[model samples]
Target: MRTIVITGGTDGMGAALARHYLGAGDRVVVVGRSRAKFDALLTSATAARAEFIAADLSSVADGRRVVEHLRAGHERIDALVLAASFVRQRRHVTAEGHEASWVLFFVSKFVFVTGLAAQFGAAERPVVVNTAVPGARADAIDFDDLEMSEKFTFARSNAQQRRANELLGILAAEANPDLAYVTWGPARIVRSSFAGDVGTAMKVGAAVLGKLLGQRPDAAVRPVIGIIDAPSPGRAAFRGAKRRPLTIGAHDDKDAARLAAAVEDGR
Candidate 1:
């Protein structure tokens, strides 16, 4: 059975993915901050095949701790599913002194995929599924203000994070020639717990969007599973089931390297 490591596996699309893999009898390890939520995900039938690591992924320390824990326990990881990111409507700095969204959304994935490289090398067919909506916004990353200490709007913050992830897939795939990297987002809205986490007005708007254009998590996760089961060459991005041509900002090696250096330097 394939071993899948999923972050944010207690809720929404992440939870849906955890359930899917467990139901398929694959060994699953989930990383999340909440013990209660992790407990809630474990049913008697699936409990034996699943594991959880409690991590506040916003902290750089917690991210490293998770990497160390996974390395200690897992010898071969077939897939690393990065579904951990929070919706911070307000500008908040994490305890690690980094911007809340930036750390969880980009840096945490960086730590996991990069730190677990040896484990991935052990597997015959290794892949990293980064669930951030890549190519959703072509907004350039602000190197001067990676933390967004200047003008912090929710849109700009998420945009930069997503763009950075695109670069992440680009660079990571190039670095690990054997590994397949896929960045996927539902072109249609997904009515997951994400809507509930936002502000009241945005929540209502999300609800309406859900009613009009959103899909359930189960439906949205199908394409991702398909790609994982059958590996793709190099790296790719998908908006829903349709694959996006990576001719856009995804192939900018200069920018990708810049982002990688920043993350390594703890930007």
Candidate 2:
């Protein structure tokens, strides 16, 4: 059985994907910030080969620690799924002095991929998938002030971080050609806690929109399941349950290189 490591597996799309993978008899590792939720997930999953790691993936140090912990435990990882990103009400910083959402959604993912590339090498042909939205492709990245302390617009931050995920995937794909890097649109999950941190206005807006068009947990797992088992043609975003390709955005070689440099510079 191939080993799959999924972040943010305590709830939402992550948990749904975990359930799907476990049902398929794969060895699954669920990583998140909640022990109680993790335990509950395991209890519900009841996978003989499932494991959980309680981690605050919002810190670079924690990301590093997770890799060390995994190295001590496993020989190889077949897939790494980043399903832990969220939208916050306001700008918050982690103990590691990073923008919390950016750290979880972008930085932590970059570190994980980098660490895996270093440890496992290109021979493993691991798959890396990051969940992003349409917001990412239509925005610009703010490298000067990552926290957006001066320009703390929620919409702007959300879009920028989403773009960061794309850049991360593209750069990682370029660096390790043997690997399959994917960024997909989960297409607004109704059960996700995405708008939990936002104001009442957005919360109500999201609630109404979610009720109208958002897919259920089971409905949303189809694309992710395809990513885990099926072969995608190239670097493109999967739209809905059919796993149909959608032309979202292209990664500029220069921009990808710049993002790679910026991530290293941040270290």
Candidate 3:
């Protein structure tokens, strides 16, 4: 069976994917901060193949630590789902001095792909699926102001996070031409902890929209499963099963390299 690793696997689409893989008898490793949630998930799923590692993925240091642990523990990683996410109703910074959302949403992905480069290559068919908006580009990312300390807003921060994923995926694919790197997203919001930091009003509204327009956790992971089985090589973006065009925005090759270097240097 394939070995699967999921960040944010304690809940939401990540958890659903974990359950599915565990049922198929694949070894499933989940990384998150909550042992309680991980225990509850294991108890409910009751799979001998399931495992957990507790870490705050919002911290780049912790993200690297998880990668090291995974590299040492697993010989190969067949599929890696980068689903960890967080937001603050207002600007919030991590102890690392980087904005919390930027670290979790963007930097964490970079850490895993680069740090676990060998493990991914060791697998027969390795794929990294980032649960993020595809075909979305940032209007601008100020190289000097990545932290957004001087000026910040929820919308602006969120946009940068998404845009960063686009660049990350492209750079990763370029670095390893044979690796399958995909950015997959749903058309409607799935009710999740994603709503937690957005404020009560958004939380309530998300529940409503989730009921009306969102796909259930199980439903959301189906396409991802198919992608894992036969992923389009190189880089791709998807909205549901439909492939979306990959765009690098106005940024050029130099910008992509700079972003990758900045993330690697712990910027």
Question: What is the TM-score of each predicted model, taking all chains together?
Answer: 0.93, 0.86, 0.93
Ranking by lDDT: 1, 3, 2
Show pairs that collide, candidate 3: none
| Candidate 3 residue spans exceeding 4 A from truth | 43-46, 193-195
Instruction: Tell me the number of clashing residue pairs for each predicted model.
Output: 0, 0, 0
Question: Model 1: per-residue lDDT, tens digit, 14-63?
Answer: 88889899999999999987778888878899999999999888898899
Give candidate 1's error at residue 125 in angstroms. 1.3
Give each model's whole-structure lDDT: 0.84, 0.73, 0.81
Which one wins by TM-score: 1 or 2? Answer: 1
Candidate 3 local lDDT, 135-238, one digit each (tens): 65555567888878878887777777777777777677766666899888976677565634777887787778888888888887788999998976788888
Better of 1 and 3 by lDDT: 1
What lDDT tens digits, residue by residue, belong to model 2 across residues 1-267? 778899988788888888778877788899888778767666454657888887877787888799888877887888888888667879887777777877777788878887777434423557877776633553467767776877887778778877777667666766666677777776665656662466888888777877888888778878777776764433656655434343344545666676667777873
